[model samples]
Target: MEKLQNREISGKQKVRSAEVGTDILKALAELSPATSLSNLAEHVQMPASKVHRYLQALIASGFAQQDQVTNHYSLGREALMVGLAALASMDVLKVAAVPLAELRDALNETCFLAIWANKGATVVQLQQAVRAVTLVTQVGSVLPLLSSATGLTFAAYLPEVETAELREYELQADSNHPLADTAKYQQHLQQVRQQGLHAVHGLLMPGVDALSAPVFDAYGRVAAVLTVVGPGTVFDADEAGMAAERLKQTAEAISWRMGYTRP
Candidate 1:
């Protein structure tokens, strides 16, 4: 009888734990940006102490994080990894593979496919040139919003509020390296949006120039960035230049494959 009772208790404990975890995740998902402990506890209708305990477990498991300064809770790297794994299996990645390959082959430049995720622009795929140059980044690398061409493509397309939040986040995360003056950054983003492409010449890394264009989804949302990186001498930045035109065309092709119809 004692063994059976213990079994029942164990089952009940498992169900209760799952319920609390689900509630916590649901609350976090519904809250924008990050949620304070008090707010999150209230949202889940749980005691603050109880919520904090669960959050500690979540943090340990890489499912959530607590900002040391703000004490706000947000999803963590493991959550992002899970989402990226699912995104990788999506049809768009499969659809983009061929055109991305063609673009790299034609341009003879290193090509990257970067997707906008919770953390910002992240490189998901890369194809290196036959004679690869000294590239620093790789797949799974996060591009800085104010620096990388891939990140600028996203900054230009994402909503203003989101962009602002991201900018603040970046500033807080990298206090040492501040972004450019606001007016200058805005002007750069304006040009990127107008031209549908952005280029950086040795901004983040010496001897490397990169041109990036956005790929939109069926709903006209910027879904990904296609970036071509090569030596500064070979990667043309002029809008009418062969490399720029080819990059834009390839991005358009991928966008079309993703069901985006030009409006």
Candidate 2:
């Protein structure tokens, strides 16, 4: 079986190759139909040869369509077909994009939908603000469980043993860090599990703030974390608190769409 990991935004492979195949799919997704191969190579910074190989693989797998006239790439029919098929699957990633966009637009900040990996949080989807800011997160990236709202919320909801293991592996060991201690995070996780939400200030990146809430499946297992992240300057304490409440409500709505009902 392939292991899952949250990779940073630098084109590093933190997830399995099969999942990497999906990364290719997503990169292609964020493009106009019939993007030139040279453009994609420059965008992803891979050699054209490697890009061609991936393109061939994608073509073979029906995830990409090559234009005979333009000699460029478009999403293959099978890709769209599978995307439609995925609507009924357990994964909320494919189903959450529009809601995420709505959340981003409403909040005027970046939003993310993340799933639990064995070690940390894997960002399955993201919506960026139209205005430029300096945070370096993107779709298909991963963040440490102790450092971001998305990761912390997922960690808080995880089984105690698994949570502890992630802490042991991913949490920074320096005592000066706010979340460095196992016991402190255990207490924090208790609060999150109770309130059904989590918020952190300046944790993932200094001067940035984030709020997150879990999305649950029909069986009441957590499926993902819906997060809104912004700069602290954009959201002061009172405003951040309001956003947290909204995040919790939005997460609940998304959870309901995934078949989870609040008890």
**Backbone clash count, each prediction separately:** 0, 0
lDDT by residue (tens digit), candidate 2, 12-65: 653455575676677687676668888877777778888788789889988888
**Model 1: what TM-score?**
0.61
Model 1: runs farther than 4 Å from truth? 1-90, 132-134, 172-179
lDDT (CA) for every model shown? 0.84, 0.77
TM-scores of the candidates in the order shown: 0.61, 0.62
Off by over 4 Å in 2: 1-90, 171-176, 236-240
Structural RMSD, model 2: 19.3
Report the number of the highest-lDDT candidate.
1
For candidate 1, give the lDDT: 0.84
